[model samples]
Target: MKRLLIACETIRNEVELALKNRAVEIETIWMANTLHDSPDRLRDALQAEINKSEAAYDEILFAYGNCGNGLLGLKSEKAILVIPKYGDCIEILLSETDNLERIRTTTYFLTQGWLNGEKTLDIEYEYNLKKYGERRAKMIMNIMFKHYKNLMLIDTGAFNVEAALPRVKDIGELIGLDVVISQGSISPLEKLVSGQWDEKFCVIPPGHPTDYDDFLGISLSKP
Candidate 1:
């Protein structure tokens, strides 16, 4: 059966890395990375994509998380919708199940997709500099990032990790946050694309509308 993978640009690198060297037939459609900044925009954009590709594939897989209640009202009548139930792309980047609980409290996660996405930590800082003077930008970001003390980068094995260090170091120094690097896996995205719809996934059938409950529940079983 043919399947379409509708993914957030924020985790595009991980999804691409997951399909590497594997005989997977699913086609990918990368949604704009900036959509996550506004969930309503993300929902409108996703529904539009679903409408555009519904006839071409048997199923559509969404490689996204709850994303700040963005996926709450999205639904499709043309094809079955498959998506992960995590909170956001951060959870998808930090895809290791065991490591999530351990690191959730202390760190903010980043990935190649995130590094390149809109409103990325460094990009926001730069935007602040461009809009406001250097002194004002630093002060603005200091208040914006006051809660976190750690910047954790999850290496999903797709891009050059070392090449990203200078940017990471800059963020750490700017926010007084310690930089930590960790290993990541493609298993989550791989499974979602491969039809291995385990507990982590929500399989919504055609003609049914998805609401906030889909992402909030413990188990989103197929009917």
Candidate 2:
């Protein structure tokens, strides 16, 4: 049996789902910095965790973002990173005027297909396509389409789509893709090698708070 470390940008719901249905023993690191804004604090915090359990896992896998702490000297034997592209496009398609329930169903189907690595033949299949249409949906689809075009599906590593948006949107206001594209880059292969890869131990303490959620607990399992 191969031991693997799965480092995530936020919660490990997707990975946990995968683990429940797979055979591999997955050790997850549920990083609290979903937005990747507080590099200094996140770096300091993860380094401390690495120090305590530096001999339990064989490789590291980043479910989302770049795992900024990788640059902080964490050790790992091997690492895999999963980046999910695409937003809630179905919501954009369903005209609030359209039969709200049916539109919701269509939107849910499309988004779920995208999430589960399935392809949608026509991007505008059940969408209104006009009146409610805008370039935002197209932009999102183009990026997501290009990202998954030729990639092989890896283990399901999850991220907080809603949470990471603000900082990314802020970065977008800054320098755009040339800089933000690397937001989820992986690094520091050796420092993340703390082998204590238990899915139960993925959460870290001293989390952050946002207007988005009340008392954001950083632990893997919600408090």
Go through the candidates in order and give each one's C-alpha lDDT.
Answer: 0.78, 0.32
Model 1: lowest-lDDT 10 consecutive positions: 214-223
Over 4 Å off, model 2: 1-6, 9-11, 67-72, 76-223
TM-score of each: 0.89, 0.30
What would the per-residue lDDT of candidate 2 be over residues 1-223, giving only the tens digit for each residue? 2344534433244445445444445565565533345555655555555444445533334343223323223333222212221111122122123454443332222122233221232334224235346465455445544423121111122345445445434432322221121112111211123232332112222221111122122112221
Q: Where does model 1 exceed 4 Å of error?
A: 97-102, 217-223
Residue 61 of model 1 has an lDDT of 89
Top TM-score: which candidate number? Answer: 1
lDDT of 1: 0.78
lDDT of 2 at 199: 27
Residue 92 deviation, candidate 2, in Å?
Answer: 22
